[model samples]
Target: MAIGKLFIGRKVRDIRQANGATQAQFADMVGISTSYLNQIENNQRPVSASVLLSLAEKFGIDITELSSGQNDRLLSALTEALSDPLFETYSPSLQELKLVTQNAPGFAHALIAAHQAYRRGNEQLASLDDRLGAAPSQEVTPYDEVRDFFHFVDNYIHDLDLAAEQLATELKLGEGENYAALSGHLEAKHGVRVVRGEAGDEAIRRFDPVGRILTVSRYASAPTRDFQIAIQIAQLAAATKIDQVLKQANFRSEEAVEICRMGLYNYFAGALILPYRSFLTAARDLRHDIELLAARFEASLEQVCHRLSTLQRPGLKGVPIFFARIDRAGNITKRHSAARLQFARFGAACPLWNAHQAFETPGRIIRQTAETPDGVRYLCIATQVSKGSAGFRAANPRYALALGCEISYAGAFVYADDLDLSNRGAFDPIGISCRICERIKCTSRAVPPLKRKLVVDHRVRNPMPYEID
Candidate 1:
């Protein structure tokens, strides 16, 4: 549709033919004339963008191929896949995609396809309940997967818990300075050297297993780098135990099990870096001041929030908190919690929370009180942290992590003690059910969560205009 468009009609025709469809047949399928299709294939008549879209819908192809005049099937699949809701928020922004297309087209294509496959598998699994009608066979929900992983960590508290305690003792970190001491101790005792380097173009940090060194970006704070080192050590140290647990999980595929295992190891790494008990004590002492905690632990704000959610130690659990990490555009990258909060399996987050606000302030913590339609209320605190192997330039992507707990647990920590929490202004009501959210007063909802099916109230038109039910 743009000027000097590269017409890929011939490529489309070839793909159609390969699929055993003739020009007439394909034209019929796409609701177009065979003659028009012929013109398109021969490149005689330019295929407008709309026609290309229709043709893609007909052939199950991607419009990118026709637009770009390329015949890369993988790239086409990738483009189509990225449009999936699961990746719509998390995928690189348009500018980043342009850079990838201009500089690293291959990697861009791979990433898109990989994400598409990842989301496709998840979507298929999610639909199993309706398809199977409560079959006794299916046992693994995303919820269950999460629960099992945390269980594994709870069972294997030896390495991470003991290491942090032992290091604290040996380094004589005493009351306030154990974080730096822990970093120095790890470097000296474990031979796990840490160095500051440019955030590489692929990942935030890289652990050289053969070299036994961690190359962390200079952009990372001391605590963040130390956390990375601790996580890597935890991963390597607990690899065997993790593998054993995953093997017993009897997952359908080795790939799935491996992915789960790696994720669990990273969770443990976070735990080891911010040992739960000490951090909880510090959290209580500091009134959950994230900045103070970051300063004390030498960890990034994101790291501290993440570790906070993992304080669920069964009988001795701290406040149950829901933790979510999101990019600038409201794409959730990580979510974990024992708290009762619902999130879209394949979409953006509710826009009212402090997590989105934290992006504007970057390093500063933002707090909010929100009430869900189901009457659940929470206190959320969030801050933005850097990610990627890039600088603060256009290339460096920032992400926000928000940690929240029900209002009943508000007094258990020091997150938002000064706010007039009892007043309505002090509380920003939100909902866990996206589609069913009955709050007609909420201008932020993308779609009402399905659960909040509207019922008519003939008598009154309240700000929340849902049915009486």
Candidate 2:
């Protein structure tokens, strides 16, 4: 296989500027000529392997970090965006797209932003007449800005993760008394009290900042209570660390900043409850068994699954897993992937995926070896999880959690032991979505692919698609 050139002009410039070094000085440090460094910074030339080695040896940069993260994800998203039906006239080559993603990422981002605005604009235009209002240009939502921040970082906040891991050691959460430690710390250090709310209250956590009280719902589960306490402690004790990250994020809207802030705090809580070093050790020792890990950590099934996807701590990485939570309607509410498989960002997931079928068995974990259109096989598993309600009248949301990694790592997962991983027939075919899927024949396909040609045959007298080009 031919290796694609790695053009990280922006990243290279960022490194040099961060170290407060002149172009000539930085060029000398990286064992490159000043003119060659200028070309690399301008994206006129690709960074060579020698320069990559020098980057590691001279400045202690992680070459692997540069190879992945934003570049790979951005390229994937950009390709998906271009596959929209609206771009019927323009068909840019994969090489061209790669160049755009690598050399001029800002332009690539702007193009994607325009496409997102176009998508939102169409939705607004459809509802304008019925609502008796004119269609207005929609700016990108703060939620999307925050989601992008998390996505580009591959769902790992290193500084916050290390800090939370340290705090967990200090609080002795590994002793299995997580709730007591978090609550005591909240009260003793931050003048905050954790109290149970009234019986009929529907709110999960209601805080009075002035009164320094964190009131959690009475009907909430033990895991939820402990989680809420951790969230409070995260905000109070880790404010400085959170701010340092927020400053680097540089979100345009205050809403995005706060949303990202809460995301970081939530991350801190998860890290504290399940400290990285100990949790990773436990996960490996148990062969990545979700239920066993949940039992050992005293956490919920969903929490354990989500934590498994975030073990990307540089050199000591865990399995490259993808995690998602979906509702009965197939709406994916929470998702992250360290694996190569990218979840559909638009509509629902592929109907053929086992996640949708999980609602039938409820508590049972359904496992399968599934192959995507890209020919990447993954060992996937899904199970249903429901939150308890305050009462019969209150809403008790139920969601299905799906977790998986590449088929090669199946040996490390207990769930894959019973599967016939060697047989090609055992792998079920799946796609991101019907509209983007290139599968030629599928009964579950809701619509023909936007970019493919179709031929209908009425003489067959069947409700099946004749031929998908």
Candidate 3:
């Protein structure tokens, strides 16, 4: 394989300016001519290996930081933002996006943020129209506000993750440790009593703060019980750390702040169960086998899949995957994407996705090679998970969990074994949503695309009522 040239012009210039050094002075420090350094800084030439070494030795800078700093994230966000119908006529090249991200990252981020806000505003208006007699209010739902916060952060909070990792270490928990250790830790360290009993009909876990009693439902599985214990621990012990992170978020309403607080606590709970380095190493060794990972970490399959999407630690990153859970009605209950795949914000996912079919075959994993309308290939896996009820009359919660990664990482997945990767015919065509899908000939499309005109002809017969143009 040929090694690609490293272009760190914007990074080099930023470093030099931050150190209060002129171009000539920085050039002299790096043992390069001023003109050569200028060219490198302007991206006209790649940074030499010797210059990288000199940067590490003289300026104590990490070489990896210069090349891989938020460019991938910015690129993914920019691509999704530009995919809107408003920008249908103009699409910038990848190189142009890279240049914009490298040179004016703040501007690029602001543009993405603006686009997200616009989309949110439009969604709110559409939601208001759906309620025929209801009066419109300026206040956005707290749930949506918090969801947007997680969406913008890419579903990973670095500080909370680190704090949870540190707490996990202090608990003296080892890899593959079960809930016994965690339960004992909470009882011994936090003066909290862990009890498993019927937590009413609707609640799975209930915490009595004043009495310091954490009651988990008896119907909950061992892994669910363990996770509930961890969540309570996060609420009780990590409240200060959670609050500190929440303060910096500057949420608009107290409800949003409270919702975000619980969300962060849940994030910490997940991290505490699956520490970054250990879980990542296990994931690699197991080829990201969800069941094996769940057993290894004493977590549920959904928990393992959710953790897989959060492996965004800067230097030691895992395969980028998207995780989603949908109900039988096709409602997306949970969604996060670390890949280029983005879920539809307002409606259900595409009907063609294997996730919708997972409900048909309960407890069996279904694998599919799916391609989005944008031509990106993915190795999608889905399985139906059912939460048991305590009694016969109670309703059990059922959902289908979907996890996928780009085809380039398919080789690292155990489910991809024996699959035909090169056969383009094996890949099923899917889309983000019907409203935004551009596949005009799709028989599964329920409605016409909002951005395309519908040509209705009474004499012509087609699968759809009208032709999309």
Please count the clashing residue pairs in each candidate, in the order shown.
Answer: 12, 0, 0
TM-score on alpha carbons, each prediction: 0.58, 0.88, 0.83
Number of the predicted model whose TM-score against the real structure is largest: 2
Name the weakest run of 10 consecutive residues (lDDT summed) in model 2. Answer: 1-10
Candidate 3 local lDDT, 1-469, one digit each (tens): 1124776689999889988999999999889999999998888888888898899898878665565435655666676677677776887887778778777877886777667777766766788767767755545568877986787676888988888888888775555465777888888988899887755646688888789898888888888888899998888778888888788888879999999998998999999989888889999999999999988887899999999998878666788789999999999988888777888765568999999889899989999999988788999999999877577877788999999998989999999999998999999999988877889999999877766788999998987888887
Displacement of the residue 62 alpha carbon in candidate 3, Å: 8.8
In order, the Cα lDDT scores of the candidates are: 0.63, 0.87, 0.83
Q: Judged by lDDT relative to the true structure, which candidate is superior, 1 or 2?
A: 2
Off by over 4 Å in 1: 1-214, 217-220, 388-394, 424-426, 448-469
Report each candidate's C-alpha RMSD, comma-separated, in the order given: 22.3, 3.3, 4.0
Clash count for candidate 1 is 12
Candidate 2 per-residue lDDT, tens place, 1-469, comes to: 1124777887899999999999999998888899999998877888898898899888878776666656767787787889998898998997678778877888988888888888888888888878666656678889988887888788999999999999999998968577888899899999999999997677889899999999998888888899989999898889999999999998988999999999998999999999999999999999999999988888899989999999989877788789999999888989888887887667779999999989999889999799998788999999999988677777778999999988989999999887888998889999988878888778898878888888888777445646775
Once fitted onto the true fold, the runs of candidate 2 whose alpha carbons sit more than 4 angstroms away are 1-67
Better of 1 and 3 by TM-score: 3
Order of all candidates by TM-score, from best down to worst?
2, 3, 1
lDDT (Cα, 0-100) at 265 in candidate 2: 88
